[model samples]
Target: MKYIKIKRVMDFIFSLILLIVISPIMLCAAVAIKCGGQGPVLFKQERPGKDGVIFTIYKFRTMRLETEKDGHPLSDMERMTRVGMMLRKLSIDELPQLLNILRGNMSFIGPRPLLIQYLERYTPEQMRRHDVTPGISGWAQINGRNGIDWETRFEYDLWYVKNISFLTDLKIFLGTLAVILGTRGVNQSKSQTMEEFGVATKSLKG
Candidate 1:
């Protein structure tokens, strides 16, 4: 329990420092988005946080405003702008989440927050990932990110929940740097992002 408190302090202090250090990069990203003719510089979405609490997660907008193109709905890749793609590739899009970290809505490491719709879909075991604050990068992220299947990803998240500690977080942080530099697992093998959890089947588990 003390480490949890320590982790929150670390999240707050480091996120504050990182935000200040990265302000210029965030500004450049914002300008690029605006110049790209996108509707907004930032994308805001509701995500389930710790204990399934609802909170807004922020990222640099990475897709076009229009849902449809030339009479058909646009795929995520189709909607992605050149600048947006660059931002995503460099992981610049996630810098704004430092604010979420500062606000105590998230941590630097834990289970990545997921869509609000997913709150009801998780198995009781899977829902334990929400016992800690959501994070920008976590055990699942360093393991495989969007590249892995939902079951595997949830397994990693639960592992982190059970073994969260300074060393665990440090390992994830180091691995994240490698992942970003390598740009592996940023997207699914065949999709811009992974498919929605439990979408193909009626339930995750019988």
Candidate 2:
């Protein structure tokens, strides 16, 4: 569809512009992470994108290097640092995903990429959310983000799949600004993040 093509162009242009504009902030974030003695400034993870194809998603590291002296991974709260929390609350940690957008692995507005393990868990209908490229922000993100349940999130994803258009993307683009400024749904008040898809486990970051 023409809209899909147009959306890709928009993603490319916007991601490039955003990267240029935010480079300084990203630089500062990298310095802060290094100063905090965290493992790395950027966190890379394999996430499923369109049609369940895996791609590396990037984010600024927001967790401590280790939770235990024995090389064990840290629990969500244990790994969270003050700097990490501040970046997360400001939604600055996700700025690295603009690179994903530029790389053609993602869109600026679509269903947010999810973990690879979720490929097997999604029902046939839920899997439809992957019909388009995954995004850094999406209809689901603007709706409730980390606060919403898996079922509802999937519903929003599916809705976007069926209703994608320039106007829809514009609305999401604007709504994302509001969400970021307000930090309304970075994490659920009852918990740090929504439970993992079909797993009930917490995530690395919200």
The CA lDDT of each predicted structure is 0.89, 0.85
| Candidate 1 residue-wise lDDT, 1-206, digit = tens | 99999999999999999999989999999998999994978999999999998999999999899989779987777788989878877899999999999999999999999888887788899999999998999999988878888888899999999999999999999999998998888777444566778785456753
- Which residue pairs come into collision in candidate 1? none
Among these predictions, the greatest lDDT belongs to 1
Error of 1 at 158 (Å): 0.5
**Among all windows of ten consecutive residues in candidate 1, which has the lowest summed lDDT?**
197-206
Q: RMSD per prediction, one decimal?
A: 1.2, 3.7
